[model samples]
Target: MATKTRVPQTIDAYLAGVPDPAAKKTLTALRAQLKKLLPKATESISYQMPTFKVDGSAVAGFAFFKHHCGYYPFSGSVVPALAAELDGYVTSKSGVTFPPDQPLPAKLVKKLVQTRLAEIGTRAKKLAAAKKTLITERITDAAVKEATGHDWKAWMRVLDKAGAAGLPHKQLVTLVGRDVESGWWRQSIAVAYEQARGKRVVGETATTGFQVGVVRTLPMTAPQLWTWLTTQPERWLGPGATLNAEVGGSYVAPRRRGNPGVRGEIRVVKPGKRLRMTWQPDGWTKPATLQLTVMPKAKGASLHVHMEKLPDADVREAMRERWSKVLAQAF
Candidate 1:
């Protein structure tokens, strides 16, 4: 029996497999440039093409076709958004096809990808909200069969070959994402394996650390709540903490007494409605995230606080209790 060959698992491997030396050279240069352009983005082979993604959305990609190369600025809007700059290049709303042996201009490529990044700012907020951070609702084997036409045993058999058990949670999710195409279901499959194989357990998320959510209907209107919170955030956030109400505005806060102070930027701000910002109580590791929303009700508004990326259950519980007490007594 013939041994089946393994598919290329990375962008470098995929580029090495390209038959044409000219195309390979061109794309190699393009990849190097893109890495510099999108220093914060992750590079990988997505959809069997060289893709650069940020926040799990494909921001840019490129490939070799039969007669030419194509640059794909994903999210369905980048190419058209810069139609004026793309003149003289054979461009479609989907992607730009170029000469087989030549690459797109580095400056133009920078502008194109950066614009796409800026466009996805508010969209990233929605994506963060939409992402399945944890598998709170367990996915059953019958549900798996319904989604992918395969039962748990059969799915496990396939995952075994890919070494899914050994793969990290992110890689396992990506592997499932390629087949399922839905964010929530992809997480469900990955988490199912984690649970069955002892990789994780209930009340835990592999990516974001422990999470805590608290909601309270304050005896104040939405505008009143926003004004009080933004003007004097130190009361609940921490002493000497400042929350600039403008999106992209900078703020500072003290962490542990001995640790250095840290700075964070507000990500999204809908006046009198919602606010999302980074919370760095430790100022050492990645900062936690805090999302607050106010929804108008009878005489007052409901204030919701969703915090994630806590270090452990202790921190989660501590934060949960703190927020509960603050909201109950302070409001």
Candidate 2:
């Protein structure tokens, strides 16, 4: 009689067939890291891999391959945010790979799990808010004019004259308040101005100061574009481009061929759509903010690069030129 074959049905059973003792050990360690970070999350088999769930949503998963062990956040957002620390490791849009001989660091794994949990919380809040505020009609020029005593174009011109684009959030609000008496109308005007200028959202201010760069329709989807921006920035920015795409994560773009490079921290990351980071170019005393937004177009995607709070006009113009070349190379 032929020997019976073992088929794994659970996480423990799945690990039983890992063959290599070292690989099995690594997988077990990774599992423990996830469990420690997500104490309340339940374990199950998902997509044929060991998965951890919170509130019935798949938060993370891990698998073993012939040469590598993989950790999947189940969302494309986490990989990019942890890009810098993941150097020398294989990574994809939604997962990271470690060699069977080398397991992921406990601290790094903890951070990844924490970041995903925070993202889940943020998305839940946004969904709840979306449900509460349902706008039946589109906001139009006529509506804005009727509500604020000025047409959209007129308000835009007023903002331009006031140099609102370069102003910090608090100052910009004060500037708008000067022209608009009603508090609600002031906020409305602020949002309108920001939108007209292609800014991200209201309450986003330039701490160090504002420069803008733009690259029109490139033949790529938003996710592909995001990969280009975060995965291999050195291809466009400089020789050494290391980016950690999370809030408070660090970035370093070393100078190349006499061109200046930048170093700073990431402030915001909305996967596939937006990324905002501080920009402190080589030799700069104070840092500025850089924001990249990807919008899906008919053919491909449009990328908007905004740098704010530079020291002077010269620095801003120089950065604008550098970014223009960078985008040209990128596309």
Candidate 3:
């Protein structure tokens, strides 16, 4: 009769059960270094191997196989991204195989782990975005019919008849405008059509250059955040700021120096929910739209910063960094 083997419930058990001295020593050192680099990560046994997960996402893992050891980034794209630095090592789309006797260098291990972590972070953000409400959700089928005398399917049919799929953004908008009266509704319908046909992506519009948004979750309620934002405007808006918390009210955000002050009007104010406004700082070409919103979450709440009409990708990145800093430092 054949004997059954017990599986390891922990990484330490897995390491101890490795019969090969070289493979055990190599895996032990690699595990120690991974723990050091990923102090915040949760270590667990996944797929019968020692794995390190960060924020519920599997980043890096390792396993001992016959004749060699394997390092897994758990992402197909990670290995390809660093293919140039992986010379002399046996690599696949998912993992890298190294000789057990001559364990991977500390530098190489660091690169592999860091690259996997970065890829995981980017994937997490994209997944979060995918889970958010879509345009169709915001503009419901019934609401569309009530507002424009047609449902989404009907509007799509109308646009399709106009050859909107092959038309440029402006021309498509013009076509929609022949029926839709309001400029805002025309732009919205055109964008919705473009998104449905896979022509335009989220946070992108021909007229608005580029749009970017960032969200930060804080351990507080929406009302609490609203108080902080309305009272402590200097933290985010700028220093010596005067913000009127009402629709059609004008406001000013005076910077210290070098960076000029912003002057704008509050376009929409839904207490503890959303605040939309237009801002044009000193020496700016045109005003940019700024929207701040608060959403309730399980633990606390989320603060949202949405900026539109950015001049280019550079400005988009700059505003992203600026808002990230504000979210991190403020509240």
Candidate 4:
């Protein structure tokens, strides 16, 4: 009969008790991978396992046990797209378990981490986007106070008028279903504006110029991700010069003896949480803003990126698709 022991609090304690060498090696490799993924994560012993903190909170962790090695990214169930990939893994509310004798699925583990990280990045971007909405909410509230004098029914009428204009079926489900309380109301404002206008609701952009704004989140920590973004420019930018992460830094991409400078002022640099800089190439007419924001979840961080000042709707849509491709490659 198997005896159930109380959960341990530190990774050292769990490792000490586990007698399986394979499990130990698995744990070691996992730790190394996680370190590579999130170098900025602060380490500690919690629940008798290794826990990593991102942006001051625990985002993920690992543990060694008698039967299996456990890897947990606190918020993972929401990632439906990965369900097929994680099909064979043994999962629970807190984590997934990999057996000792069987070969550890390195790719799957990395995917899990990346997915969690992307979620965090999405959250961070939403928070930044939410701030923009908050201001609108305040204005709307003030307008209501002035016009209706606290009449709730009048507000409903205003909302109805707005909803009639915009057919926001998909966006509403995406934002509201995610429980973005702060941004939802403002979406209504967008809807209202759309309803009031007779403009056509066209799809994503088409110009290749916008394709340069590729945004993605990695499971790795800010330092690790930044290293890839800066050091691995050749992999993505097709022979880019280099990037310096400072106030007056510049990035130059050289293609066939011609050096094009991607230079701008670093707007918001909040260490590991956010980085926004101006990006203007020598030949381009408009200046673009490149923004990266990291949001932490239970076990990882999300990365939200935006390349603003795109020329037209078609270009913007193309940029969005480009970002998706970049994300798949990097994250």
Predictions in order: lDDT: 0.73, 0.72, 0.79, 0.56
Estimate TM-scores for all models.
Answer: 0.41, 0.41, 0.44, 0.40
Candidate 1, residue 297: lDDT: 90
Q: Which candidate comes out best when scored by TM-score?
A: 3
Writing each residue's lDDT as its tens digit, candidate 1 over 1-331 gives: 5443344668888788888889999999999998888788888764346878776656778887667887877544577788898989986555787886667888888998888778667555654553454333345668778887767777777788888988879999999877787798788778777866766744467976678887888898888888888898766655667777798886786653222455677998988888888877543466788888989999799889898776654456445545654574564
* Candidate 4 weakest lDDT stretch, 10 residues: 199-208
Looking at model 3, how many pairs of residues clash?
0
Better of 2 and 3 by TM-score: 3
| Candidate closer to the true structure by lDDT (higher is better), 1 or 2 | 1
Give me the candidate number with maximum lDDT. 3
Which residue segments of model 4 deviate by more than 4 Å? 1-13, 78-80, 135-145, 148-331
lDDT of 3 at 182: 83
Q: List the residue pairs that clash in candidate 2.
A: 81-245, 208-309, 209-308, 209-309, 210-308, 210-309, 211-307
Candidate 3 global Cα RMSD = 18.8
Residues 227-259, candidate 3, lDDT per residue (tens digit)? 887877876876667888899897887643325
Give the runs in model 3 whose Cα sits over 4 Å from its true position: 128-133, 137-143, 147-331
Error in Å for residue 177 of model 1? 7.6
